[model samples]
Each structure stands twice: as structure tokens, then as C-alpha cells.
Target: MKTGNQDSSAVKAPDAARAAGTDYERIFHPRRVAVAGVSPGGGVGFGTRYLTSLQAIGFEGEILPVNPKGGEIAGLSIFKNVEDIPGELDLIVIAVAAEAVLPILEAGRKKGAAGAVIITSGFRELGTSEGIGREDEVRRIAASGIRVIGPNCFGIYCPKSGLTFFPNPDLSRESGPVAFLSQSGGLASDFMMTGMWMGLRFSKVVSFGNGADLREAELLRYLADDPETGVIAMYVEGVRDGSEFLDALKAAAAKKPVVILKGGLSSAGGRAVVSHTASLGGSRVIWESVLRQAGAVQVRDLQEMAQACLAFSLLPERVYRGLSFTGGGGALGIAACDAAETFGLEVPPLGTDARGRVEALLPKSGASGVNPVDVANPYAPPALLEKIFRAVAGDSRIDLQILIVLTHHFKGLAQDQGKTIEEVFPYRELADRMKAVAVETDKPVVFVLPNAKRGFPDMDVVEIHAKVREAFLERGLPVFDEIGDAMRAIGHVNRCYGKGETS
Candidate 1:
């Protein structure tokens, strides 16, 4: 409930000191976690689901479930109250009704819990006086000691510690440099799911719904100095304190890349946000200006945000000015150039010598070796494509390269050879060659594996394309479904580092 209008000196000295000395490590990597409001009958409520998710993720910590009329759940004894817990709790997840949230929170605070995540709703978002009063009470208890993640949220996801969202049991356990924060639990869950297939591994993800106490600004500052995080992404509807949020954003961006997806910029979306989180979604113009001023990369939607995070997580930190685009078909080449230019990137033509080498290796019938090296054949062999990529990358002006593979077209070849698309297209070999070429040439090569045929008849092709994408991603190459998405992601990287911005 901390607002922009609140004076800085209003915070109690002890509370400020406690906030300053927060045990983020224990909060994120707790050894003992408690879940309040779990059902003894094994129902699918948030608390029960969270307990199951923690188990599914292979959580190596002790889990204590709480319910007033508790028996047992998942072979673990359920405590009747937080006060009845045996020892100090590192973290507590509150999922009881709104009316019962404060008592559990107070008990956890008195038990010396490091933090709490309240999954219960019926907060200020209800837009009712009772709801508002309930939220204020929760905030007051939080201000006394314990840090709170939510009053209506999915809670935190830490890959390193096997802590997952309530509904997310399949999220990746492989930890990486990206940390994401969101006000919407659904968006946070969706992003984590999307990031799994998109080759985005995360360090931590927090959906601080309603953000009763610990929210954007404080979390930003914590992740800024977190050694495990290299890139920060956020789905923000609105912030409590504009000035504090900007300062935190600026500091975080200064330390590492911060990609923001500001929801509710449109009038209707803003109204939805107010109803959703009791937040004030400011004007789009103002948000854009503020993000740019804070030196953050602003994305439009979840897909774009995930793509930007992927680029930041995988690509080198330096900006890429010039690019070498390689693909089949004349139209694809044209599209690549247009997209690159739209993203402030240049597909510079290869040098005379390099162009000659590429042209010599390409088919003489319909191939071009200028910039967007058109092989003119969707079924180009991996060796030939490798030679072409190397030739294009030899240009000193080229800082990066993109190879667009029309993997779906291999279906025709598959049918002709009476084989599956995966059998016919040497995707693994191509991935290996691309990785080698990138290593030898000292230029990163992005892959665009477009599958225009996704109908029922083309399911085989779709499967093969997915395998191909996974292969490339395993080799440390970023893959995109379209050239525009790839360019836009790279463009974000360029805007962050190319302009000498804070990110």
C-alpha cells in the first residue's frame, strides 16, 4: 500500500532497517517452506496444487501444510496453525480465505519466517471497502516485519531451488541468467511456459499480484545486484510509486539488460488493469518515454518480451550493427532486408572477394550471393549452406548473420524419398555446421525456421521443424519462427547496447 504520495520519512526506522537487511537468499532458496490452507481431502485448491507442484519440481526442502481441520496431504502431516509449526519457517505460502490471511501472516512473521506469498484473492482488486480494508490490514502486518510477495498471485519460481508457481509443474529446472517480474500471475505462468520451448531459461520469476508489500521497485533493486541474473524482464501494469520505480529501473538497467512489457497502455487495457490489480495504468506515451529514459527495452507483448529475453540471454552483450542474411527464395531475402532495416539493422553486401566465393559455391541457376544469400533451393545441403554462411560471414563489416531455413518445404523431398521430413532434412548436421561456422567466423548466426504449413496434413513437417529448432537451440543458436521476430529481438539488443544506453 506504499503510494507515490507517501513521504519518504514516513517509513518506521526499524522497518526500513529490516527491509535493508532482507535475507533475499533465504527468501529465494528457502530450506523449509510452509503452505497454509491445504485441503486434507486432496482437492485441487491453490495450496494443494502448490504443494504438489513443489514436489513435482523435486523441491529438496521440507514442506509443511497447514489447515485448521487438517489430517494429511501427500503423506505429509498438516499443521493446524502457523504457531503450531515446530521451528522457524524460511517461507510461507498463504492460500486461505481473505478473512483468514492476516492471522496466518502474523503467525508466520512471529515464527521468524523470511518471507510470505499470499495466494488468496479478495483484496483491493475487488474495488470494495471491505476488500480495501482487508488489503490494508495485510500491508500493515507486512510492514511490521515479513516481506510479502502477493495477496492474489501465483507466487515465485526459482529454477535453482526447484520452487515453482502453483500451476506450473513442468517449468524448466535448468537455471539461466534471466529474471522476470510480473503483476499478473497468468502472464507470468504463460511466459514461463513459452520460455521453455523458446529456449529461455530463467533464474527467477515472481508474479507479485496486487503487490501488497514487496513489488516492482524493491524487487528490481534486488535483482539488479543478483549475481545469478544477467537479464531482467518484467510485465508491469502499473507501479505504486512512479519516482521510486523509475529510479530502481534506471539502476537495474545500468547493471544489466531490463526488458519491459508494459500492459494496459491502451484505454480499454488500462481499465482492465485497474480492475485486475487495482493499479493505475498510465498513458502509453508516458510509459514509453519513461522506459526509454530509464534505458530499458520496451516490448509490446509476451511473445516479443520472450524473444527479447532470449536474445539478451544467448547473444553477446555487444551491439550488432551489420548483418548477413541467408535464406532461400527471393521474397524471403527481401523480407529479411526490410525487417532488418525496420529494426535499425543493415544487411550490408559482402565484399567483392567474399561474394565471389559464395556465388561460386551456390547453384548457378537461381542463386544470389550479394547480402541475403539466396540459395534458391529450400533443400540446400548443409555443406553448401555452411560454405555460403562462411563466405558471407567473412565480410569484415558483418557483425552477425541470420540463416532462414524453409524446413517445411522438405516435406516434398520427404514424400519423394518415401521418408519422414526429419529423416530427409539433415537438421542435426546443419545445426552442427552452423555452430562450427559461427565459432570459426566469430559472428553469431541466428536461425529462422519458418513453418508456413501447420495444418493437420502438415503435422509431420511441423514436428520436424520443432526438432530442427531444438537442435539449433541446443547448439546455442537462437531460433525464431519469422524473420521479423528475429530482427526485432536483435533490434532490442542493438538499442540497449548500440546506443550506449543503460541496458
Candidate 2:
């Protein structure tokens, strides 16, 4: 996974290395990591968190904890310093105080560390003279051949390498085709967690705060050619070199879809940006124009970003004519039509052949035969739903088909039948049908539970939702909570990649 030519001989600042092309390949695939400033007792200190996170993520690489106290933590012997480590260090995590960062980095460099993730704050964001001077010193040290991720940030998460800032046992370790770079550490975690819930997995994620080193443009260029990454998402505030950033963004977008969510668009947000990462908040209009010209999709929130990434990762690489959906109630179908039109998506009526087939499979009492086909009682047999799925997906007029389930009503139907929802709904069979339809058709097939609720106190409902959603996700089908969000996400991807006639 060589990103580019490695000019390791030329010692240049990360920002100035645009011409030199510093290889960030080693940063994401390190074999041996040393965590400095780990304290005893294994409290939630940043250093301890990194150590535990690596262990919890089942990192196979050698982990060496460093502290001057020379004590054992979690039964691992703590080295007094990185220099005391037995072998070359591929990466080091620095969580010491502001004044203590340089010496640790220097020692790590002496121990042949290729990269360092500085999780310590109190640098330039402090707005103090000493802090500014310290940050400058960091830049100078960064010029000495060692790549850096942050001076005030959460580091990185590479599930393949089992490297994480914070690890969850239940999080998917299987690598997917999405990569994310964020300026805010908190936003990075939020995007990962939310994306996971939405059935989106990432190839790699970086929280590069302050951008003292490892500029966003360099990371963007690296991901552009990365074999594992098919979709790139970014949360940014500003860039140091506007022209270079634009060029890299354009290059990346030309190869794969790029979704950006720019923070600090508002005046108040701008002020917060300066204090948060010491970034310059560019004007919204200029940023929008630049993004549009670069052929990048600019999203407003994490939800939009996640959904757009999912669409790019899952949808077929073909032009879509319009979108259509089935199931749910008539009112929900009406809402879907409204939302689709609002997002510049068309809800054109299904072609006669497809409509005839769907209507035949559905009951005559309350079924909708047109575009947003309403199946009033969605508790019908799995075969009938699959027939409708195949008919709509194979239709010439419709490009994308959404299967809508009003979950509450489905559960009610199960109760009325004196059985559990799983017994009545046949989630496993439906998931198998959806997967089969997706693979057989060139058109995209998506499942939607428009009224899906989160954090339900009823464990039964929660378990059912998890089981169904997980089934779809495991088979490479995306599930959404609302029709509007699903369409909006698909619409953004369509517009960016020159897909549909409308959106």
C-alpha cells in the first residue's frame, strides 16, 4: 500500500513536502508501537486509554508502555523512555504535558520512530506566547524526518491494524471501503459511532487536530490512491494552502467520491474554530464555490456525510433515472414523495408492467399500485415482498428501489398473530431476498424503516431492530431510519458523480 514515492532523504516540513511526497503509509500500518506518558493504576488518562484501546482492539503488534516511574501497568513492564525499547519503533503516542512533548518526540526519533501521534493539548490552541513557541518547535521537529498526526487531537483508528484511540468490543473489525479525516477528535468519534449504527464501516479514520503536521491535503492525496479506501469523508475547518488543497481535492474527487462537512461556517462557529484547533474559518460562499468546482460533495452534518458515503460504497456505478419505494402506510408514502421531490429526486410512477406485478402480489384492500406503493399490512409473506422487490428493481423506469417497513405496525401485526415479530416478519428470509435482489440486478436495492427508533427501553424491540438491521448490513445492503435521509444521501451521491437526470 505504498501511497507515493518516499523521499525520506529530504527533511522538509509536512506542509512543504507536497513536492517531496512524504509517505504516510507507515502511519496506518505500524508493527511496533510505544505509548509514552502512561500512568499507573490504568485510569482513563489519554496515554492509558491508548494502551488499553490497542489491547482491547486485539492489536497483534508489540505494545511497549513508557513512563519515568519505571513501574508495571496492567502487568506490562513500563519502560523509562522510548530509547530504552529493545527495537525500532514504527509509531509512538505522546500524551505528556505541553512542555514534555518535545523530549519524548526527540527520544522516539532517536529510537527510529517513523511517526508520532501527539494527543497532548496546551499548544497553539492555548493562545499563549509559550504555547505558540512550543507549536513552532513541534513544526521544526516534524521537519526532521518523523511524521506527526496531532499536537492536540485524538489519533487514528485502523481496524485492520487494531489501532484505535478508543476501542469498543462490539465495533466491527472487518475493514470496509470508507475512509474519514477529521479536524475535531470528538467529531471523529461521533461520525464513527453514528456510522457504525447506520451499518457503515471504515477502512481508516484520522483525527488530525491543529494540522501542525499531516495536513488534510496530504492525507486526501494519500487516500485517493489507497486501495482499501473507495470513499473519502472529511470534517474540516480550514486549510493552510488553499490552492494546493483545492488541487488535491480535485484530484481525489476525480478518482473517487469525496464528501466534506465544513465546520465554522457561521461567525460564532468561526470563533470556536480558532479556539478549538487554531484554524482560520474561511467564508462560507467562497468555500462552497471551491468545493463545487472541485467536484466534491459538501454535506451539512454527520448524518448526511455517513449516508452519502454509504450510498457511494454500496450503489452501483450506473446512471439512475429515478427512485421509487414500497410498503409502509399511504401517509408515509406521501411523505416519501414529498421528501424525494424536495431533494431534487423524482418519484416517477412505476412502469405499467412493474406496477401490474406488484399489485398482483399485494392485497387489493389497501395496497398502492403506483410509485410510492403502500403495502398497508407489511406482515405479508417474505415471498410476496421479494416479488415486489424484484419487480421494482428490475423495472426500466425506476433506478433505485426502497423497501419501507413501518416497524411499529409490523410488531403490532406479530402481536395480533400471537407471535414475535421475528416469527411473523421473517427478517432472515427478507434479508436473504434483499441480498439476492441486490446481486442479481444492476439497479440499487435499499431497505428503509422510516420510523425506526433508537434507545428503546423495550429490549424486545431493540433486539429485533438490531437483528434485522445487522442482517441487511452483513449482506451489503444499507438500512435507513427515514426515507428523507436515505434519499438525501442518495441524491447527494447522484449529483456529485453525474448519475441521474435530476438527482
lDDT for model 1, on a 0 to 1 scale? Answer: 0.89
Model 2 regions lying over 4 Å from their true place: 1-21, 166-171, 267-282, 452-459, 499-503
Residue 92 miss distance in model 2 (angstroms): 0.8
lDDT of 2 by residue, 431-496 (tens): 888788778876667888754544554556667877888888888888887888888887777787
For model 2, the run of ten residues with the poorest summed lDDT: 1-10
Best model number under TM-score: 1
* Cα RMSD for candidates in order: 4.4, 5.8
Please name the candidate that would achieve the greatest lDDT relative to the true structure: 1
lDDT of each: 0.89, 0.81
Kindly list the per-residue Cα lDDT of model 1 for residues 7-44, writing each as its tens digit: 65453344446668888888999999999989999899
Error of 2 at 168 (Å): 5.9
**Clash counts for the predictions, in order:** 0, 0
TM-score of 2: 0.90
